[model samples]
Target: MTTRILIAGGGYVGLYTALRLQRRLRRGEAEVTVVNPENYMVYRPLLPEVASGTLEPRHAVVPLRAVLRGSRFIAGRLTGIDTERKVASVAPTAGPWLELDYDELVIGLGATSKLAPVPGLAETGIGFNSLAEAAHLRDHVLRQLEIASATTDTELRKRALTFVFVGGGYTGVEAIAELQDMAIDVLAGYPELDAGEMRWVLVEAMDRILTTVSRELADRAMTELTGRGIDIRLGTQLESVEEGELRLSDGSKFFADTLVWVAGTRPQTVVGELGLPVDGRGRLVVDQAMRVEGHPGIWAAGDCAGVPDPETGRVSPPTAQHAVRQAEQLGDNLVATLRGEWPRPFRYRSRGEFVTLGKNKAVGEAFGREFDGALAWTLRRGYYATQIPTWNRTIRVLGDWLVGMPFGHDVVNFGSREEPRGAFEEAAGRSRVG
Candidate 1:
């Protein structure tokens, strides 16, 4: 009988695991199935570029069907899992829930934004986690500039020009830097809005930013950002947000039309509902082999799994590098189990880390060697371009970069794309009335 392997979530773990299985499995040895809500997987690292108009939104995502030709693709969300019956429930876009049976199940459901209980935050703040959010941010930022330029009220202009980002990690730092760079680049186009008028603030509860990198590199990034007139408030917290007015922990209040919440992320809510062993952080408790504890044939990896780091003996940080390695290991172990061979533990050493700080500017460490400025930027770009999967997407991403270098930032706001049918709807309504 052929082994049925169902992989849930089409993020880094799901895609890589399926790819590994496709390559290793003998013909008819196992049937691989991948189910995800979206048909495409967003290459999250390029989201900052997407937000800054450096890369097209479509290029940052990989079509699941196009790449996973060898595996069965199901466009749906995993509703639940029945471990005893070896079945999983899925809810498609518009249909009854479908149940799937599998010999082995892989949980790679990934994570969602962890929003704080700040007043009005849920209503006002925007997250930079998804492709839609990133693209919307680009259009929103440009719209804000237009609003600032056209507004006669000084208060409205201040609110429109003021942008606040909460979080000092890779997401917050990179996002603010890229958007700020874009705003500055396009400032010349708006004669009414001066560069000095726009205010960019980065709020972090910690004393320093980029906690993942060395203090030296973090300091260097801080210097670079501060030099660009971005206000970095360390040991500060966002107390509340009400009616576009933000009150900080340090007793300061300001109005900002744009508030990006990149504070942190937690495992998806559905992961908790699966009735699996999860850590205090709500991540699935999985062994180094990426197998769920006490659940044979049930595996988990990536942001949804609390995978023990071999080196640190702690739960591995949810990074793309670690997720890819874990997925590969999970795939091999599954294959080994099927072949009646011993499996190996997942192990990975830190090769390097890169943090992009706008166009032609970055900070990173590779092989114990620290780098900053343009060299770090180039290294970061090259690494992501190669890692995004598929030759087609790789070419498109690089082409965007190459084409953008000469043309500079594109200021055209396609916000109307979101409401593409609005005009048609109005026309139809007018005709009906007539």
Candidate 2:
């Protein structure tokens, strides 16, 4: 008998789960297939460096073809899953809806950028979640310095040099820190532009930044950021961003050309389309075994699924750490189910939280102890290197770091911003043509 398995989303959970599934399942008993919009599993932990031009954009992405040796990999975005029919509709690049049938399904579609509207945000603001965004940010930041140096107009120059970061989680903090470091180095090339003139603001609605870490560390982070002249705004909100106006909750107004929205993410909408049992937050509800409740032969994990934490009695924090662990155990449970054995519950405590700040600076808490500055930075890199699933990636990343230590950033603009714009841009061009 052939048991066909299909896994969705090629992120941390999807890739790792499939890797484990292929290893654990009997040779002829089951055939595993994984589907994802991206053909590669992006090592998202290093995206900050990519945005800052510290790491090549491609360095963080591991191609699925090379990684998933045994399992069949499909490049497609999931449209819907009919649990009753046990069929999945996939929409690949420019093709009819591809149908895939699965005896068992793993929902790991991962989270998406929660782009709640703030007026003019889409056009003017950049996001920090994707490879494209990382590259664009690097180019934009460098270009800003060049523009500022050549331009005599003070307002235009200020607008160009100013950078706004909207969220203050690990992504926002690390991004601001790394980019700030990079900008300082890049500014050395332009004699006219003082690095001090460039403004970096970290905007967060919460009372403090890096709330995931301990309060002591969060306060230290706040002091460090402020000391570096990065304005830390708390209990505030962005009302809108139109033209030059950036309205805020504290009756404050600011103007800048750059706005980086790290506001956070939500699960993919395909989960709702699947008509599976979902939580209020649009995440799939899974048991301790990582199996979807009331659904036969179906399982879900990662940020897209609500896996409860036994210690807290709440859903597990949707971090990369938890996602990988869930996938690992989920694989083991599925293998046990295939063998007609009782599956074990997914139970693990979060080891700690860590955030990187530029080259040799970081802040973290591990095993109830706090580590900051150089030591934390080393631990951060060490932990991720170990966490990365493949030896090939581990070696490549380590080599890159070794070279980057003495030699500074390898910054280059590959020019990805030339995608054709709409009628408005065409109209402007037409007016010029006349």
Candidate 3:
């Protein structure tokens, strides 16, 4: 009998695992089915560029159907799992719940922003995790510029021009830097708005930013950002956000129209509901081979799984590189188990880490060497271009970069795109009255 493999989530792990299985498995070897909320996988590292209009929103995502040709794809969410019966419950986009039986299951249902109990934050602050959020941020920032330029009220203008980011990690730093760069570049078009009036503040509870990188690199990044007029508030916490007012632990009070929250992330809520062995951080417990402990046919990886790192003897840090490597090992292990062969343990050393500051600006360490500025930026782009899966996407990404260097950032605001049906609704109302 052919084995049934079900992979949940279409992020890095899900996509890569399915790709590996499709390539390795022979005809009638095993049936693979993938379930995910979105039909496309967002290239997360390029999200900063997407927010800055350096790359188009569509170009930053890989269409799942286009890439996962061999496996069955279901556009839905994995709601629950029955480990005893080996059945998974899926809720499709426009249908009833589905019960899928699988001989082996892979859980890669990524993470979501971890929100603190800061007052009014849930209602007021926005996250920078998804593609939609990145695109929305671009439009929102442009709208703020328009508001600042047209308004004569001093306080309102100050609020509109002020942008606050809470977090000092990779996402927080990269996002603020890219968006700030874009705003400065487009300031010439807003003749009424002065660049000096814009305030970009990055608040971090920790003493340093980018703890994953070295202190020298972090300090270098800090210097680069501060040189660009961004306020780097170290060891500061966001106390509260009330009615557009921001209170910090450092006894500072401010009112800013835009507040971006990128503090940290936790696994998807459904992961907890799966009744599996998870660590204290709520990540599924998996051995070095990416297999869930006590559950023979169940496997997990990526941000949602506490996959042990052989080199460090600790759970692997949730990063794109680690996730990709883990997925490959998981796929290979699954194949080995089916063939009655012993699976090898997943082992990988850190090649490097790159943090993009802005266009042609980055800091990275590769091959035991530290690099910064344009060289690091180019290396980062080249690495991601090759890792983005399909050649079609690779060409489009490179083309965007080539076009962007000469033409500069696109400043057009398409905030209306969010409400594409508004015009139709208004027309329908008018027709009814007529």
Estimate the TM-score of every prediction: 0.98, 0.94, 0.98
Better of 1 and 2 by lDDT: 1
Score residue 402 of candidate 2 by CA lDDT. Answer: 76
> On residues 155-191, what C-alpha lDDT tens digit does candidate 2 reach at each position?
8998988899999888899999999988887665678
Model 3 vs. true fold: TM: 0.98
Model 1 lDDT tens row, 1-434: 99999999999999999999999999999999999999999999999999999999999999999999999999999999998999999998778889999999999999999999999999999999999999999999999999999999999999999999999998999999999999999988999999999999999999999987788889999999999999999999999999989999999999999999999899999999999998999999988898899999999999999998888998887788999899999999999999999878999987899999999999999988999989999999999999999999999999999999877788899999999999999999999999
Off by over 4 Å in 3: 429-434
**Candidate order (TM-score):** 1, 3, 2
Count of backbone collisions in candidate 3: 0
Every candidate's lDDT? 0.94, 0.85, 0.93
Q: What is the lDDT of residue 69 in candidate 3?
A: 90
List where candidate 2 sits over 4 angstroms from the true fold.
416-434
lDDT score, candidate 3: 0.93
Better of 2 and 3 by lDDT: 3
Which tens-of-lDDT digit does each residue in 210-242 have in candidate 3? 876789888989999999999999999999999
Error of 1 at 64 (Å): 0.7
